[model samples]
Target: MDAVPLLRISRPHRLSEEVGAVLEKHIRSGEFGPGEKLPAEARLAEQFAVSRAVVREAIARLKADGLLESRQGSGVYVAQCLGAGVFRMAAGVRGEAHPIEDIFELRLIIEVAAAERAALRRTPADVEAIEAALARMDEAVALSADGVRADDDFHCAIASASGNPLIGRFVAFVSHEFSASRAPTWSREGIVRGLAGAAQDEHRAVHAAIVAGDPAAARRAARQHLLRAARRLGVVLAAPPGARGEDMDEETS
Candidate 1:
């Protein structure tokens, strides 16, 4: 029964995700109190200026997050007790002190092990998924686009290939959190071009190690790629444990 906030949907991000974020914010702010019924789907669609399908997807995301519940033959209502708090990563804005280094450190911990496991466990299907994502990234680069979605997909594919569903889910969450910082638009044109090309080369190295079923090589390549990526964004992560001199040497080589 609370007033819905105005939403201005932007490009280059999924509509459902944007809508879901708005709804989540209102719920967390207590504007939409616990146990209160939400507006009808049609009303929500009209309010958000999106189709019913988009509204549906946004609501579904909330349900999955355990922030809402549905009763048979009754409208959706906010959950009486908020379950586990939703995890989020805000887009790093210029001039604001964000923990960019800490984020990359988390990625190094998650993705390095993921790449190693993927190399050992990936099937032909998983390889194809990773390859397809890379092809999309290459095409986006050729068109001078940022390729953020494809880049996200590439990392998610690698995580899924690890054969641990939980790892795959965590990687997707991490990618979403870090995606805003990955866009090259704030940099000069020359730098954007150089970063895109260099990033592609690094991605291919990881792919090559996975295809060869070389676990150690894959771990090294994934770790090196993330480190270089962080530097591109002006972040320097503290060295995680187990990164020995030999491994660092191999990464540079």
Candidate 2:
């Protein structure tokens, strides 16, 4: 019944994200405390000067982030626990100039270790899945596509093969967070070909080491691939723990 402070969205791109951020800020600031019901979707949409569909998307994202919950025959309310103890990509991180670079640093920590375990624990079927994802990437590259999904699938396969479900989940989460970062890099026409080609080669190196069941080599390969990926995006990652601090000369296929 009181006046709402939701601002009208001006930018067209990533409408849902903007709306979600506004609502999340309110929640975090205690304006919408735990168990407090939010305004109806239609009302929120009108306040934001956006469609109901956009409001729905924003709500869904908040739900996924554990900031909100729904009740049967009732509207959405702020979550009671507010995702306590859960690992979340902070809102500030996503707003940074190279947010994905920070995520890449996380991947270097999680995925490099996962790749080593995958080489040790992967079964024949796991190898098949990894190869299948690799094939899809190859097809996308040959067709001059960005292959972002295929690239994600390739890393996820290795995560699955790690024999640790927690590692798999964390890898998938970080990968999702960093996905938007790839679009800009691929959107550039002049470098897409070279970038995709180099990426594919690095992927092959990782796959080869895993297929050979060589844990140390797999670790090395995975680290090199992620480091090279950051380079392709014009990002420089500070060497994470256990990294050999390899230079550009060492990132060969």
Candidate 3:
């Protein structure tokens, strides 16, 4: 009798993550239909050329995502795929560059509105909160650090100052994706000391407009900030792996 062929399980890092990704791929591609029972853990282990423990771990991950259900005295089955948008957003963004632009596009609408509203509604306390966030960023930059968290705080502060709890919550919801997008760009060449300086200045401009109670200027500043950010990220994406370079730099941003 001939033995069945097992797939490769290469990639030495985060075995459970890879396992969950493979299972997610199968589920997404309909290899396992809705409500259909998955193969036994032992069978899955053989198919993936991994131990039952790894398979068990991956199943646990899927269950956490509400993708699978384990019934008493029975095997695991696929859950009905409801709230798919919730699932898509809930799948935390990590180390990937594809979703950055989409996230930025969403930010434009929300952030522009927030900036305009902040200009109209900002109080003494709101200004203080924003300035404190800026101060943190300044300290980070002076010490040559990643100010990504402060950057997030600055934006969220603006959302809060807009006087709408809904806007603040919306920004918070999309923030994980936004931060994931920034991680790669912030690590790019010319980012820490070069473009970061520009970003700091841009943020100051937005703050100034908000403080001066100029809604139009705040809106323009916020819009321009995102445009510059997108350009900078593109420069980073063009760079080669492990090479701090951005080729095709003719179209200067």
Using lDDT, give the best candidate's number. Answer: 1
Best by TM-score: 1
> How do all the candidates rank in terms of lDDT, highest first?
1, 2, 3
Measured on C-alpha atoms, candidate 2 has an lDDT of: 0.79
What TM-score fits each model?
0.62, 0.60, 0.55
- As a TM-score, model 2 comes out at 0.60
User: Which candidate do you rate higher for TM-score, 1 or 3?
Assistant: 1
Per residue, candidate 2 scores C-alpha lDDT tens digits across 137-205 of 788767776677667768878998999977865665555555665554344461454777787788899
- CA lDDT scores, all candidates in order: 0.81, 0.79, 0.75
Model 1: CA > 4 A from native: 1-62, 66-85, 90-98, 185-193, 247-253
RMSD value for candidate 3: 17.5
Task: Return the clash pairs for model 1, or none.
Answer: none
What lDDT would candidate 1 get against the real structure? 0.81
Displacement of residue 140 (Cα, Å) in model 2 is 0.6
After TM-score superposition, what is the CA distance of residue 107 in candidate 3 from its true location, in Å?
Answer: 0.8
